[model samples]
Target chain A: MSTVQITRLSMPKWGLSMTEGTVVQWLVEEGTILEQGDEVIEVESEKINNAVESPAPGVLRRQVAKEGDVVPVGGLLGVIADAEVPDSEIDAFVEEFEATFVPEEEEAAGPEPEKVEIGGKSIQYLKMGESDATPLVLIHGFGGDINIWVFNQETLSTERPVYALDLPGHGGSVKDVGSGDLDSFAGIVAGFLDAMGIEKAHLAGHSMGGAVAAAIAIQHPERVASVTLIASAGLGEEINSDYIEGFIAANRRREMKRVLGTLFANPDLVTRQLVNDVLAYKRLDGVDEALRAVADSLFPDGKQANVLDISRIQAPVLVIWGDKDEVVPASHAQNASSGAKVETIENAGHSVQMEAAGKVNRLISGFLDEAES
Target chain B: MARRITFMQAINEALAQEMERDETVVVFGEDNAGGAGAPGEDDAWGGVMGVTKGLYGKYPGRVLDTPISESAFVGAAAGAAASGLRPVAELMFVDFFGVCMDQIYNQAAKFRYMFGGKAVTPMVIRTMFGAGIRAAAQHSQSLYPIFTHIPGLKVVVPSNPYDAKGLMIASIRDDDPVIFFENKVLYSVEGDVPEESYEIPLGEAEYVREGDDVTIVAIGRMVSMAEQAADALEDEGVECEIVDPRTTSPLDEEAIYESVENTGRLVVVDESNPRCSLASDIAALVAQNCFDHLKAAPRMVTAPHTPPPFSPALEDLYVPDPERVAAAVRETLGTSDRARA
Candidate 1:
């Protein structure tokens, strides 16, 4: 059989900080036939836990890494191949891969996120992959950073160069949110693309970020290729203002954990590290005022203040939402423009891109490809 | 992004950032700027362990190398704080606390209360504590319990690099006198610390590891040992919840009580001597308040009443290790013999 018949399932590097993950357990047993995006194993990093999906559509031939085993990113976890594939072949493959594999070296360190002064304000963004396809730019929601794309960026980057940016008042960027409005956020992103010298690129965003992307597509149609919204805002007037207020007021871990639980379908997924990270961000010098400013501007009186018309954008629009999303109701997916394709994923929550990363990534990459084509 | 740095570097960064932020923030202690007047090079020694190594050059007049007199310098540090300047005075080894007890405990600790809150002693007295580098009796003693006993005095014991920076910044900004203790063995230990200036509020205890079998309250360097013990206990089906109090004074009584209430078993591991130590103090608190939730008697793992040993073998035996912590946990759970303590 050709080498293409077998595919190795390896540990995934979730974010910039994650170098390795421990195998929590095998979600699916050997000999179980799985679709390409089926979750095969549960792996945990220090920051959070995620399900590792199958790389190929085939029967799980062998479990190379056992439960409770610590594996570095790119280290083989299991093997997938046709049911007729010999068992000896899978064993030999695992052994050979281990012998040849070297842990990711610092010498080949991926490009570190770069910070630029956009309109005299510091903007932090990470540029990943290098390919001859339409670049994809990712914008995170309120209280989120570039890490919101931890699941989708690396996966989707294989098809083209992808950019993930930290909005003002988040992550490594300066805690100054001028105007603290959607228009300002859209302007900063447009300026970021200008600084990076990208003339036009596909845009994707989450929650509040979706509004920014939609605003950009409306404001600067010449600078956009396509727009993809994941559990996005601005389509509907109703939003979970309690979550926004709770996130801003949560200085302690317990409160922050409760606020983050609204984002995920599984409340258990809101790990200590995640809560600590959000708390640290909230505690920054100007973060509180910035968050309050943005909240007052957009989500005043517990309502989405501004609603953009996505149909006006000439570019293709793909709106994806988690059916179980609590922060922004998944029913808002239906509010998408008639020209937009809306997909509501089941059992996922506000962070559909992270909860169902496999399907979300596939949908995003495919949409971007068709738009670029 | 979080940049991983040594405990020593974290302390240095906190000092630098605070000094840069406020002109009133001054750093002075013995050998703070070691080679100032007599040597060929300037900014040579940045304290005994170089935690303040490069500060002399960055802030010329602010980094003062005081005479080798603890009473004089520490007294001066207190005086400066009361006079409107934020002084960060390094006590070098906490064993030297005896020479300046009146200055720290009497004057600085009492300024705010005695003066009816009219005076604010924004001073941080940084010192090295714990027994690890064979520093022997005088140098290795964890004398924070003495400071914790005194009212109006805040005692901080940071376990790792991240806490070291945050607590240092917080202590510097605090209006009252703060005793910041750094473990000698933890100086080289490395962890993630943010480049920006942020403070971890005092009195908040961090749960290093969460489990249900037993509550392990470990202070300072003992926190890491408790973590190691928790890992070992996990293999034996004995899960441990480890709590690092971070600050001895203004202790988070609620955290300790809540933890013990959940597990029904308590083990406090402190590197200080057994008498009036944090281990004994926490055990008593849990015993008193969490009485109804207790499944067994609270256990304490502490150093012997004797001074630390000079020899490596005896010193290793004298200090509380993971084995002792694990044994204490097992004893509290009735899974091991009590004689091991």
Candidate 2:
């Protein structure tokens, strides 16, 4: 039999603040065939429920972690090898990996987010992977920051550079949102790219960010090569004013949890950590006024006031939305003009990027790839 | 900056400096913005007592005035804290804790331990405590011991303007939930406070007056009385050691033990009722912890176990005074082992 080498399968870090996770169950038994991105195990953390995906395709020759075992990030959970590898070597390798493996100190420190000042305001943005490919800038919705892309950024960045930023009035960015309009928000995004010295790149945005990306392509055409909108705004007049109003008005946990629940098809995705994130933003000194200003000025009566003129957008636009989106109403998908390609994801909600990340990623990747070709 | 300012001004300065230093610090309470929803000038009150006066204009939107609803806003502050906001919620009076105690004791205090140690509720509840303002029983009370009883809550009672300012700033930055008590009577009393932002450790106690004759433990407003009693005893050559436990929950029991060990005599001055009061608690702690060091039985001078009287003369008698505290110290000093029996 031909000898086969296998890499030790280490525990994966799913989100930004996940330090350690409990291995709830292993999906595949020992010596099972495993494909790249296959769900090897289910790990539960303080943040969210995530299925650990296999990084490489191989036969799962050994399981190092048992069910209901608590392990730190980077601890070996399993081993993958070609079927040709002898069983004796696999058994010896499992013992050695467990006995000698030491979890990385950096993993224990958790995912560290970085910040840079742009336009005199501190902008927090997380960069993943070291690919020479042009960086893809990910902008979150009205009340989100860089952490929303925690699920996709690291995985997608393996193929190219990826960056997610906190816009003004959100996350670590300056709490003051001047005028709290899309134009100002788009200007800040463009200014941020300019400050970072990026001339052209793919832009991906969620909800309100979708409209901002659309506006960016229309106004600063040279800076954006392509645009991807996830449950984006500016597509139509139909939006859940209740979600917007509830988000702005929610100051307590129970209330914020209910409002955030409207963003996802699986209301369970609106976890305590998620509500805590929004509360943290709302509690900041100027964040409440900033949010209120944006809500009043942009979506005063539950309708988006700023709509991008699709005709002016020069870049290729790919619009993705959840068929069951309660936030921006699935009806808005009909508003996309002739040129833009639209895909309504079934069994998803307002947070299409989060609920259907793989499909959304494939759609965005294909659109950008065609644009590059 | 070193000159005297009212306790309320000192508190205001501490809050203003903290808000300036950290963008996360915010101040909100009923009438915190003064004229909320009113036709006259905005921020007319700065607070009900004008302690937060001028902050609304200085840090617009940061200092907020909420509706009379305490639970909603106080719980909001706790929720905000768990997320990322370090909010300072004012309950107006500690007596009003009835309206928002769940937010403070249950939510803010337990987030750390109950969340599997993943959450940090960095919040501060600032409220007026103690009596002598003639605000009646409903608006006046020293409930620090009740808050101190909660495991995760840090109860802070600053005895003077200096401790009030420093401890308020410290409470704002502390990772655990802190209940900061401001004696209403001391708010108008002047003292020297630093202009810069600084923090005094939460669990530390300060020895105001050092003497070996007797160890007097006081809290909040009672510290001043103990000091006065110590001063009056100086002429008679009966030197008294005064120890102020700035925080009751993270009680500086070691400090009390050490003072008792040195003085071999103890007298506790408390403004609260004599039973189950902080004074009695401290007296019990010293009696149990330093039984061998005692020259006489521990003495506690406190108000009667009853609601604070409404009349000025009766109220004055109801609150523990310096003369009474001095008399307790003298009684404890005069009694020998045979005399005590």
Candidate 3:
């Protein structure tokens, strides 16, 4: 609606719980031209640190927030406009935006994660941005919770409803994963959709949850619109058993930190709070037994017990993996059917969804848009 | 969602949760159930600081109010623990431990070894310690180092609410007799604690802050002081890594050793007197094991070797503060303001 295009690249609200973020440093300076998805600034919340990307193609006109300054969610970080835009106009724009901007209140109205009993198992999920359009379902890997989508869920839910869930034996869900195999988990997720009254959804899963999504598409083809797998299992025969065994045996924060380091290419991403959180989860009652059962059933004898046929999938499929993935090989993406699309992100590991969320979200968004059309 | 509660509330929650899980667990102290049958308010004081306040109403018969004889009740706790009840007896003040030392150091500690490993004294003696309340010489003392000297006894001194809950649960479930020390000053200190029961394994140290310039190993309430020092030190272009050894008996020597070796400098901050305290213990550990890695003599900041004073000003000066700890850090780094002058 404006004759002069101006974009406010404010602080991104990564998850439901994040109220503010401190600007660590700016990667790109003002007056530099930026592409749609270039890394512009590094911001850190209490949970983790990540770089904020550009919203659109423009010349960064002014850096509004200084490094080390704490800014509330949606507060302005920098202004983006064309080079031909006058300085007076840009200043007016910045002044007008800050004058009208109000950070969110204490999150009383923000979305919250809810629990649903699926086949007598409590599964916690966060639902965002409701619409009649085909909903998108997010599935976390083994030993993960609904918080894994701290970077993906909110952005993907802008148009269609997105649901991120904690599988059995993880997060706030019941720490009872009966049999803890691919098909049992698949059935639980299928029942979860039924409990939520979601008829069909575009399913996306990471790591162990990927196998669950693929199994759903294979067994209950009617409930799946499309399938997206990120460094997924069920298509491959090999998994890093050391990481599996180490995760179950690491009861202390120091050992847990070393174990979580293998998940990311940049081990520095593994913060003290992350390790403490994982340790807290593992220390809960019955969680140790649940993880053991899941590991024994899923990765028996240091190898995947059941490798599904990705060829049997009826829904459109998109396979994404980090080229540097150490836990599960990226070469497994080669197993995708000719009809499916595959992508491998460079310099990311098994946790490609979290390490490179912006790129993964863009890829999934583009794939889902094409599939829906 | 993260819910912030006080350290006292955390300990109470841990007791409630463990009692709910294991029916054999029982709680008794001088005023834990202030007045049981002959009182207007059933759950009166909770304890001296209300740490066990409401448990009597929930589990009436289980929570008992003991007579003010520490030796008698403590010996009874040891007997109850050996006879099958996992009793958590509160020693009102650690200063009273002299009367119950034989029961703790001899009878309860040697059971498993003396009984050919067949017997276990699963007991926890929760007591209050520290000098900030101006309780004078008799009531205020940092005596955890004394318990750490005894065998077959686990010593836990938690610094915050989260650790308070986890360490309390762990101490309750431990097979050995555990001496759980709570600082009266930290009763109202708040931190995020989960509602569910969890355990932080004994002998593991928490890295409160990770830095490369120096290592500060602070015990109990000194952990927060070291954190404050680290923050001020950070502004001066010095990064200090802080290590909180949650348990003094089963010390994580490896963590302390590795941290000191990495930074090549150490400062041990303990609220106890310097002689044979955790500060000296850790300093000696690093000196013996990490000698080749040392860049300077390890400095220690501790209270003077004297009975705590009743004068408010002297008592305030008696306890270690952030400025003293930061000064010790600067002394080790050779960046002291005096050195600059």
On lDDT, the candidate that comes out on top is 3
**Interface RMSD values for all candidates:** 1.8, 12.8, 2.0
Better of 2 and 3 by lDDT: 3
Stretches of candidate 1 off by over 4 Å are A1-9, A23-33, A58-108, B1-5, B28-84, B106-120, B133-135, B188-192, B207-217, B223-243, B252-268, B283-301, B311-313, B321-341
TM-score of chain A of each: 0.96, 0.86, 0.97
True contacts kept of 2: 0.00
Better of 1 and 2 by DockQ: 1
Candidate 3 lDDT over B233-316, as tens digits, reads: 878877789999999989999889889888988999999998999999999999999999887889999999999999999999
Top-TM-score candidate index: 3
Alpha carbon lDDT of residue B108, candidate 1? 94
Residue lDDT tens for model 1, B94-167 = 99988999999899999999999999999999999889798889899988899999999999999999999989
**Which residue pairs overlap in candidate 1's backbone?**
none
lDDT of 2 by residue, B1-341 (tens): 14688889989998999988888888898888776554444536887888888888888779888888899999989998999989998888888888888888888899999999999999888888777878778877777778877899999999888778878877898999998888888888998764545566677777776676889999988998999999998777676888898899799898789889988999998887777888889988888999999989899898888777778888899889999999998888786552221
Q: A193-269, model 1: which lDDT tens digit per residue? A: 99988999999999999999999999999999999999998988999989999988887777788999999998887
Model 2 residue runs over 4 Å out of place are A5-9, A26-35, A56-63, A79-89, A106-120, A130-132, A309-311, A337-346, A362-367, B1-14, B17-341
Q: Which lDDT value does model 1 have at B290? A: 96
Ranking by lDDT: 3, 1, 2
Poorly placed runs, candidate 3 (over 4 Å): A1-11, A17-34, A40-45, A58-109, B1-4, B31-37, B40-46, B54-65, B79-85, B110-119, B209-216, B225-242, B254-267, B283-299, B322-341
